[model samples]
Target: MKLSDRQEKIIDLVRVGQPVTSVALADKLGVTRAALRADLAILTMIGTLDARPKVGYVYSDKPKRNLLLDYISDIKVSEIMSKPAVISESTMVYDAIVYLFLNDVGTVFVENNGNLVGAASRKDFLKISIGGTDIHKVPVGIIMTRMPNIICGRADDSAYEIASKIIEHEIDSIPIVETLKVDGDKEQYKIIGKVSKTNITKLFVKMGKSK
Candidate 1:
């Protein structure tokens, strides 16, 4: 879409000197932190923004910028992991393929009794398809990588750590996970949002145009 005048202004400022804190920029813009946050969220959703700790918001003008390394270092997996799309062990290969394609997502989380069990990716679907297995007869459990040493991140940690791990491990995604606390609080982890190539690409485009 269309960006408003203020949004365009924000882009210009970020392009010149990113790694700037929201507080600093917000003050200059004469807007409340809350209002600025709302605007940032809007820009981010449309792939025009990114944020990190110690370096505030970043407008990536470099197309090849290592956002995962340069900016996401302060972010946690919980902050950027997209909502989990769960499938049972019994889910059919045919149906799984449909789900992945329909959602335009690269992978889906396999769950059993609300606990993460495994992961299935587009590559898995392709493999299955090539195996000549009966898509309808086979269950996802038959082919999915079982207990694939899931990579996870906690909400309390910095996103930078999460991004670093992703790059180091050569993995594209991480599941945000949490355990219970001593105070009888139900420890829950819901993938809040996702940070991927898509997120980085949006930031690059927005910053490039701004410059």
Candidate 2:
């Protein structure tokens, strides 16, 4: 969410001053108390300010590291995820290889009827390529690692949680998915985006530069 000029000033004031009364802020801004109400409420809701019954408002006490974590924690996977490299499950291993290289991504999501069913990585392609088998005749579905074995992130998952999943799985990328109910009892994930270590690194770099 974007902050208004008055709200930005309010944040600056709270950061440098002791708990400041709304009346004082209103006077300093040459506006009425009512004018600052919405700004204060928004700042408070976004964790930029804290208010008490009689103490007025103050900046949050969160340290720099914790503040960065808070920022990351509030970012959803959808905000950072990039276009996924996708292929049909029936795509031949040779075609999948070409697609992977063209996309320049580490993994490709395999889909059937628009729902994620499997994924193929460089390793999966390599395994088949080196077997001396006919890559052109082998469908990726035969060698792709199917869902239930795949580690994925939800579109609403926090950036911090998705980053943790990447580290824990020791994989280059993970598909961002949305859940769907099928057949009245089974659930499936539909791939929507992809997140990678590179994306996380870029986020950290951008945040650091902002500091």
**Candidate 2 lDDT, 1-211, residue by residue in tens:** 5778888899888888859999989998999999888988877776788897798898885424555677899988888899999999899999999999999988988999988999999988998899999999999999999988889999899989999999998888899988999999788788889999988988788777943
lDDT of 1 by residue, 1-211 (tens): 5778888888888878786788877888998888888778776655566777677888754432354345545544444446656788789989988887777877777776565667777888898898888899998888887664766666666655665676888666566665534448645344434455454445446546753
Model 2: weakest 10-residue lDDT segment is 61-70
The list of candidate 2 runs beyond 4 A from truth reads: 1-63
RMSD of each: 12.4, 7.2
| Candidate 1 ranges beyond 4 A from true positions | 1-72, 180-195, 200-211
| Best candidate (score: TM-score) | 2
TM-score of 2: 0.67
Worst 10 residues of 1 by lDDT: 60-69
TM-score of each: 0.54, 0.67
Candidate 1 all-Cα RMSD = 12.4
Top-lDDT structure, candidate number:
2
